[model samples]
Target: MPNWLLPENIADVLPSEARKIEDLRRLILDNFRLHGYELVMPPMLEYLESLLAGAGQDTEGMTFKLVDQLSGRTLGVRADMTTQVARIDAHLLNRASLTRLCYAGSVLRTLPQGLHATREPFQIGAEIYGHAGLEADAEIQHLALTSLALAGITQVRLDLCHVGILRAIIAEDATAQKDEMALVKLLEAKDTPGLQVMSADYAPITREALLALPNLYGDITVLDRARQVLPALPAIASALDQLQALAEAAGPECVTIDLADLRGYHYESGAIFGAYVPGLPNALVRGGRYDHVGEAFGRSRPATGFSMDLRELARLMPGAQRKLAIRAPWSTEAGLKEKLQECIVALRKAGEIVIQNLPGHENDQDEFNCDRAVVLENGHWVIKNLD
Candidate 1:
């Protein structure tokens, strides 16, 4: 293999794509700040236990683990940033009131999430801690939608799900609770036959509820159907009510429900959601409430957040145009050089992109589009339009 070859599903981002990604990152983070979210930069790697504090098997499987040389403890490359931010809130800050935190960084996964997905993703997101009410969930959902809009992804479909629904159903039957993981997989796949065979020994009501889940997906009206078809367990009712409130808050036009979609079933404590747009088979963003995550860090607080791969989201956006620049010639004459440098500095200070053309690279074509040039006309630097 060639020395320049990169690992599979990992490749370098060249100038154009990198520019788009960086610009989008700044835009989203700035919006987050405006919404009162403080930025936090967590390390890319940490002790395995701390990294997977309240995460489930999925996160564990995704995390890349290695033994630490100094502490001799196992360390993990973070596959997700939510848990790290949660730990910060629980131990580092320990604030009592509502705390909003946002982060943007690279995360490594042991395996690629999809056929064309990257093993290393530029993850960007925001989290709200200490607020357990449905209002916080609504705020997060709205924030996510607004962020997508800022990225020019306007035709979005917000599919909402609640982990509590399945938890409530499984709580009614010991057999189903024992086979929770298997049942969750079946539900996610919408495998009615598999669920039927596995849930045969479950209580009749549990089996019926489990079977009913696969069909309980569609617009907000699905909630009404779920209320009618599923058993009226108090927990189930509460989960449905919360889902309804959040869906209404998100607006009925683009909101939908999926009772069987249990993507974050193990990690999320309450409502979960995913935002999808055209041209992408997978969701562009995923988030929900994980109130129990902080408990593992010794400070349990209500928390909810959402994250998206900035690289992937950037691909969906229109390519960034080459920035207009002021091209200046390099000069070595004492007086002329100083004056030319001053002019270039002044232009740059005024937010203009200034590119100094090297002696030999007079006709070099590069990233910046230089439509204007700084020339030493009659002993003074002046700007002139390039022919």
Candidate 2:
């Protein structure tokens, strides 16, 4: 095997792609700051129990675990940043008032999420804590859409779902509650026959509701259909109402509903959403309310947030153009040397990229496009257009 060969689904990002990713990261982080979201940086690895505190089985499966040589405790490489941010809100910051936090960092997953996905994803997201109302969920949803819009992905489909719907359906039914994980799997796959077989021993209403869920997906009208088809339990009704409100808030044109989607069913408490863009088949961003996550840190707070892989998002954008730069010749001539150094410093200070070419590298081609040149013309250093 070649020594330079990277692991499967893991590859180095060269100059152009790295530039795009960095630009998008700055743009999105700036937008988050403008929205009053304070940035937080959590360690890439932490004690396994702490890392997986409120994260569900799915995150556990994705996380990479190892034993720490110093502390001798099991440590985990974060597969997601949401739980870490939640822990910060619950323990470290411990603010009594509403707190908004955002983070951007690389996470290592045990496996790639998709065939072509990278195991090392640069994740960026924002979370709102201390508010349990639908308003917090709405704010997070809008911020996610805005972030994508800032990235030039204007045409987006925001697919919304509520974990509460399924929670409500199985609340009283012991059979359905016991088979929750299996039911979620079936629902996510939209496996009607599978769901039918799984729910055979469930209560008639529970069985019917479980079967009805697979078909309850589409535009906002799906909510109306959901109201009629699903039971009239308060929790179910409340979930539908919240979904409707968020759908209306996001505007009907760009919104869709998928009661059976259940992407974050295990950890998400309510109003889960996935933002889909034109080129990507899967969601470009995923977020929702996870009000119970903070409890794992011994302080329960209402929280909602969304995250997207900056690496993946950058891939969808056009390649960044080579930045224009000024090429300067390296000089050691007694009088010209001092003046030339001053000229380079001044140009750089004024926000110009000045690349000093060594004598032997006069024909070198590099990342920056040197469209201009610094020359000692007529005994004074000045800028001139490169021929």
Candidate 3:
């Protein structure tokens, strides 16, 4: 293999791992369906103008741009599913006043240093468009919780923040946006001194908020501290109230708020949230509201969506254990192979994994790796239990 031929961050998923990932995605999509969110497979490639219309800064840098041969127009591979859903909401489903859309597909983008460095990631997510209140936010949070529950994750931690709060504060100080972006990265890294450096030149109110950012973690009480520091903004206050209600709805055990969390695209204008399993360094799921994206696309609809990185969630799953092969030792005769295939189909229908016996390659070691064995001996069906 030539050294420069391979892409920098793409990795192949082998059969065993791919099977588990498919199963995981199925579980998540089923839960989405159960909640009345219909599945949608937006086109993997869309016109470059349409695709980039609503995507914020975080996604812009990652999009893989190209030109279409047939149409002779600029085109791009979707870097994320959220913007495509927004396009559908604004145009394809333009007649529908309210929509709930779900999707599962691979998004191509440059991976950050710590994100397992996989540029191609499988994303499963939902979007709720045309609603613009706390109820919408609550519903999004509920979807996140129930999806995790269906995945057999009993201990999920939520880190919630309001982009409105950060944006509101930053608007007062022009320097704050540049500073806060750097400060957010430092805070996410848990570096207090770095945060101080970022906020050093800001006014007292802004600097104090940045200094206090690290301590804005913990339970609902942290909201009280937020109120004390930046009390006047109604948008921030209403967002805080919304979080309180959402926490009550999510229950104390499954959710918690970390005001310091600043993940997601930069255009978020309302609440932003992330989901984490205990040991993972990054969030498995992320989302927020970006009302401006609609206007950016020449549509007036406000939208909010969340997407779970199926790759990261697949890793954190407790039962990511690989399934052993199931082998059959039936004779290679036409009649016997047909009967064996019938049995294998039945087992598969019952949600069991089965491996067909390879002709002319059967050995004792191959037979032992299977869950069970069925063999034809003396015209009788002989069953052997490997386990």
1-387 in candidate 1: lDDT tens per residue? 899999999989988899999989999999999999999999988998888877634599999999999999999999999889988999999999999999999999879887599999999999999988888999999999999989988999999999998988989688888899999999999999999999899899999999999999999999999999999889999999999999889888899899888998888899999999998899989999999888888988899999999999988987788889888999999999999998988999999999898888865544688899998899999999998
RMSD to native for every prediction? 1.2, 1.2, 3.8
What lDDT does model 1 reach?
A: 0.91
The window of 10 residues in a row where model 3 has the poorest summed lDDT is 362-371
Q: lDDT of candidate 3? A: 0.75
Q: How many clashing residue pairs appear in each of the predictions shown? A: 0, 0, 0
TM-scores of all models?
0.98, 0.98, 0.83
Better of 1 and 3 by TM-score: 1
Instruction: Give the per-residue lDDT of model 2 (tens digit) for 1-387.
Output: 999999888899987888889999999999999999999999999999988887634589898899999999999999998888988998999999999999999999889887589999999999999998989999999999999888899999999999999999999999788899989999999999999888888899999999999999899999999999999999999999999999999999899999999988888888999999988888999999988888889999788999999999999888787889999999999989999999999999999999998888874544689999998888999999987
Off by over 4 Å in 3: 2-6, 113-115, 170-211, 318-355, 363-371, 377-387
Please say which candidate is ahead in lDDT: 1 or 3.
1
Which runs in model 1 stand beyond 4 Å of their true positions?
363-366
